[model samples]
Target: MFMGDGMSLPTLAAARTLLGQRAGRPGEETQLSFEAFPTVGLAKTYCVNSQTADSSCSATALLCGVKSNAFTLGLTAAVPRRDCAASQVPAARLDSVAAWALAAGRDAGVVTTTRVTHASPAGIYARAAERNWETDADVLADGVDVDACPDIAHQLVHLAPGNQFKVILGGGRREFLNITSVDDEGTPGKRTDGRNLIEEWQADKARRNVTYQYAWNHEQLLQANATLPEYLLGLFESDHLRYNLETDHTTEPTLAELTEVAIRMLSRNEKGFFLFVEGGRIDHAHHDNQVHLALDETIELSAAVARALQLLDEKDSLIVVTADHTHVMAFNGYSTRGADVLGPSNMRDSAGVPFMTLSYTNGPGRRPDVDGRRPDVTLEEGFRSPRWRTHVDVPLASETHGSDDVPVFAWGVHHEMFSGLYEQSHVPHRMAYAGCFGGGPQACDAAAAPSALVMPLVMALLALLRALA
Candidate 1:
């Protein structure tokens, strides 16, 4: 659970001046990490209790700590409303800490840069209603019943209930076939849903003995074969997989090469796995305000969290990093740490004088010109453009979602319960009580009681000034 891709809090305080560091204002602990909340009063209880921290209520509060509504997933928060009446909704189905680590037998995987049926990796494997309608226009505009909304290509050929996912990589190969199907690299326009979901996940891994591989590129995901079929499925593209500044020349791979081939196919399942990697275009470069493509998708989501801290082991793995809301893009003035985080000498101007790099505090057809050049356009283009800087400024706003407050980082094991201020659906029950699966530390004592005494002495004095800077 170390997902970083559209983390806001002033773009992590302008990406802490490109690593010279700032945020908590101490020192060191850099290598980028953060945890701050308040996403506009948790998005007004996620759009009036239809719970929506967006990214599908932060992927159902980080894969089922429960907090639906915002086009739900997994289900809880009283299910219902898919325009009701599918026998009146309500069966709900909670579980999911990757199905409780595949029901304690461990080994579970989901890597993504987007399109493992989108919406934050299909809210960790299916539960629909427009997280971009995973196709079939997301079950005919969320009225359900496109054979009842399973979708992420029918949950990667059936996931949950004791099928222990070995490793299912990203991208959505056109929601698993039917646009005129044809894989084997001919690349036809598939997705009519003729159920070729990769041949029904290779015929359900040859009658459930499990051991599969279905890649799409990067030399068949680096010539797969980690002893065949640890249940891997790559899906290079069909929608939403392309920004590493537009896939570095395609043939697709990088999200740190699909999280290092999903940590070598879920670390060869020695029963110690629950992986979910998503850098999801940092929320499409903050829904297109494109701050240099959202700081190069937050530096490739911190290079996939430095490739999961170079293959996990921070004391029996826990990792937790976070983000599900925030995006206003800030950096009030001042520069010179590492600078050049893509232009305008990092930024200044307004007599503090720096001079243009990029800007936007408000959007959608701006105006104002008493003969100052660049105006005369308005082809029925209504107006509004508060000369962009940062923070809210509406009128016809599109580049949205900024209820400010996002930043959550942790190292490992019980990560001191993600230090400080919570409630974006109590971050998946504080990461399912740091992976022992809930009910631990008295079930996150009121959400880890205000960052338990100032986030470990301020992240141990900023990790000793980022290890002696």
Candidate 2:
């Protein structure tokens, strides 16, 4: 499964055009990698408690096969955010697709451009009352007992599915190291418990008599013995990996490179493997209203998906591409053929000012009126820079998520199962059904055969009913 966090339809459309223009072709003639999928569907992204979903709950829904409250991960709505006691209830904790895959004797791994403990990737293993609790220090500062509610990073190293993962690659190394220790990048660790989880992880793997390798930079990752390690862990940065535009090729790996390595490691298991790849920094870029960065991240995600396709066998494997949520970024204006997506539009507004081709509903990019005239986006000093923020209607410290329904694209085996509009929670269920794992109805089960036949019709009816409701 591949998820591009906060990748809305608008973002994809704009990114496709931008990519084509860079290739010296008519913008509309291009397609993002996932756009070529054989089957496509839409998913409603609202959370149990909010009209607009947050990454935590949306990821839980996408991975756990159930909807959860906003700001919570791997829990049912019964466990509200910040309610540590309630989160301890066994019934409240949800098992994600990763757990299901592991239980079925399939190896699983995760790759992302964000912290491994961040909400989206953490949804695969960590169950937390609050998404911010990435380390012992964070939990302690929240007035929560670290022993009772282990931090997300601790869960990744010590918990069941996460510990069993064959390949774990991403950033957030500081969360795994002791506070007194410094990383190769000279960044201080944040754990207050003095536990160096990375070292502990190595010791655990050694105790199991299994071969493992850990890499802190791109050179080490590239030089890793391709067929030697049974498990691999790579952390290239203390926080999220640098955005692709600013990444150091020698020190940090691109999303496509991470995806390629993760596949090579996980595919060693004859029982097959389940891998989760996330373009998580796209969300961070969207929050900052940096449309250029967000679009570049989306393009990187497309490349990663393309890389995965090259290594996978469509006859047996199932590949899914979707987003956990959507951003408030809006792409509009009638620009001439092959115009720059990051530049101002050709048409002037009623006030005789050229607005950006891409803008936001609310963000730090909100411009104040000067003498009753909106600032012309074309005149901004850094308007062409990747760090430039597009214009927004409402002022906010950071842009917010949109309640828009996200698109789901599918290819490979049983792709037909994901062909109609459905709730976001239905995503993993469909995947589980197709993969014939998890407690849900499975494609391999005789009783589920009939229901699977009419699922598309039923889904279409439900969507119509929802619209009517």
Candidate 3:
């Protein structure tokens, strides 16, 4: 499955227009890979406690089959947010689809543009009272429950069994090393516990006699597929891989390449596999009000989905594409059919002022005048390019996520179950049923109706052959 972070319906529409316009057509007719999926459904991306949820809560609802409070991962609403003491409760914790699949003897892996222990990926395995507890430094941040609640990175290394997630690939190298040691970028480590988790993982691999390999950069990762190790861990950048627009493809690989490598490695499992790929930084770009960056991230995620489709069996393997939440960016103004989506609207306002075709409810784009009303927004002199910030209605340094329903697109096994609106928590259950995981071992049986159509003809042919004998 692929999760497009902060991908709203309007975002998809705007991006689609730009995509086709760049493809030498009137951009409105094109469809992104997710948009073209056969079965589409809407998911209500809200948590139990709030109308609009953060990644931590929404991801839990997406992966764990339960809605959790904001800033908490892998725990239900019974657990208080940011209270270190209540984090020790057993009922507070919840199991993930990853664990469910692992217990059923299938391999699982997670690939993300953000840190591996970040909110969405952490929902698959790690648990924390606060999502900010990504490192030991954060566990102690503002006197959090360092003892009762371990950091997310720590749980990834120590809490999981040896066979857990045969593959773990993403950024944040220094977060695993000791605080005393310098990171790949020469920054001090964030872990206060003296334990160098990376080295510990390596030692454990050796002691247990598992074929494991570690890659700190892209070059080493490139060599990984050739050798085909049993376990792979790649920690590429200190933070998120650069925004798609800002990425230097020479130094770091794109999200598509990472996903391709992960699929190649995990395909070795004979029992079957479950993979989670997160286009995590799309949300980050939206928060910063960078429209191009967000669109490029979505485009990259769609490419990754296409790559997986090429690698997996369409008849058996199910593919689900969805978003954890929505952003505040909105499409406005009445423009021509083929108008540049990123440029200003075709028509003018009452004051003979043209606003941007794309604007936010609240963001840095709102440059207000003396009376607090935004002035006439116009294209720069001599620049007809469609690249510029959209005007905004409210003033805020960073835009907040939108509280609304997001779309879910699916293909392969049991795609019909995704036809109607459902709570976000139903995602994992439906996927489990479609993929024949957990308690839904026979749920996918009815999906093979087409293959069953040939059975009666084959039976008749067999009886005729026996009569001839």
Which of the numbered candidates is closest to the native, going by highest lDDT?
Answer: 2
Each model's backbone clash number: 30, 0, 1
- lDDT per residue for candidate 3 within 139-205, as digits (tens), equals 8875875667888887887786323788888887767877789877686677888978788777777
User: TM per model?
Assistant: 0.31, 0.94, 0.90
> Which candidate wins on TM-score?
2
Better of 2 and 3 by TM-score: 2
Q: lDDT (0-100) at residue 178 of candidate 3?
A: 73
Model 2 over residues 25-128: C-alpha lDDT tens digits? Answer: 86867999889999999999999999999999999999998998999999999998888999999999999999999999889999999999999999999999
| C-alpha-based local distance difference test score of model 2 | 0.92
Residue by residue across 85-122, what tens digits does model 1's lDDT show?
Answer: 33225576556677766665667788887777777766
Candidate 2 all-Cα RMSD: 7.2
Could you tell me which 10 consecutive residues in candidate 3 have the lowest summed lDDT? 379-388
RMSD of each: 21.5, 7.2, 6.1
How would you order the candidates by TM-score, starting with the best? 2, 3, 1
Worst 10 residues of 2 by lDDT: 219-228
The lDDT values for all models are 0.61, 0.92, 0.82
